[model samples]
Target: VLAQNLVIQSSSEIRKPGDSVKMSCKTSGFTFTDEYIHWIQQVPGKEIKWIGRINPWDGGTVYSSSMKERFTMTTDNSITTAHLQIDRLRGEDSATYYCARDTMSNQGYLPYKNIPKQ
Candidate 1:
């Protein structure tokens, strides 16, 4: 089988706490709808945070409690893309973001299998 990679893209911007930003993840070399796409956040010199995840096939999402109020997860199967939108950004929100595939064979499991970015 050919290897596949997940590509994430977002423009860096300077904004205040109330501002919002949108980031995207596009997949290549595999069936995009076959896996779940997850978003992650990392503040400078801090641990990684799990933002949320989306099912590309149906657009369903589940977010971390810490992120429920300001983070939204979405996906477009037609474009093989996933998106993360953050609203009311705070100073603490300044960080590097990433998109990764949830490679767990069983959806019932909670541990991340592997994260390719951030």
Candidate 2:
């Protein structure tokens, strides 16, 4: 149900090496108002990998070990949106991005399921 909401939501895009990019991951299917929106990177002809995680409910950011000081996180409780911004984007930043709602409770929180190649 939550996935349906995200699929229909139109997200904005960001330009490389420019100002910060803001893409929101809104949720409203379970107890997600106080949850984590985990961001990931999907490279062409490759698999998706963890990028960073943002606790929209509390404005906390947990970046990958190698990704520290590369990204930032914010949230708008009124809009139920979690936004991620990467500074000074590089070639490595050029990839498809996804956000998953994760929280202590597993309700309405389905792990990111990728499409298998045929």
* RMSD to the hidden true structure, all candidates: 6.2, 5.7
Pick by lDDT: which candidate is best? 1
Residue 31 CA displacement from its true place in model 1, Å:
1.0
TM-score, cand. 2 vs. native: 0.69
Writing each residue's lDDT as its tens digit, candidate 1 over 1-118 gives 1134646465565666677877766666568888887877776688878788888877888889989998998887888877778788777877777777777322322221221212
Question: What do the candidate models score in CA lDDT, each in turn?
Answer: 0.69, 0.61
Off by over 4 Å in 2: 1-19, 103-118
Q: What would you estimate as the lDDT of candidate 2? A: 0.61
Per-residue CA lDDT of candidate 2, range 23-58, in tens?
556666555565677777676788766777777666
Which residue pairs clash within candidate 2? none
> Which one wins on TM-score?
1
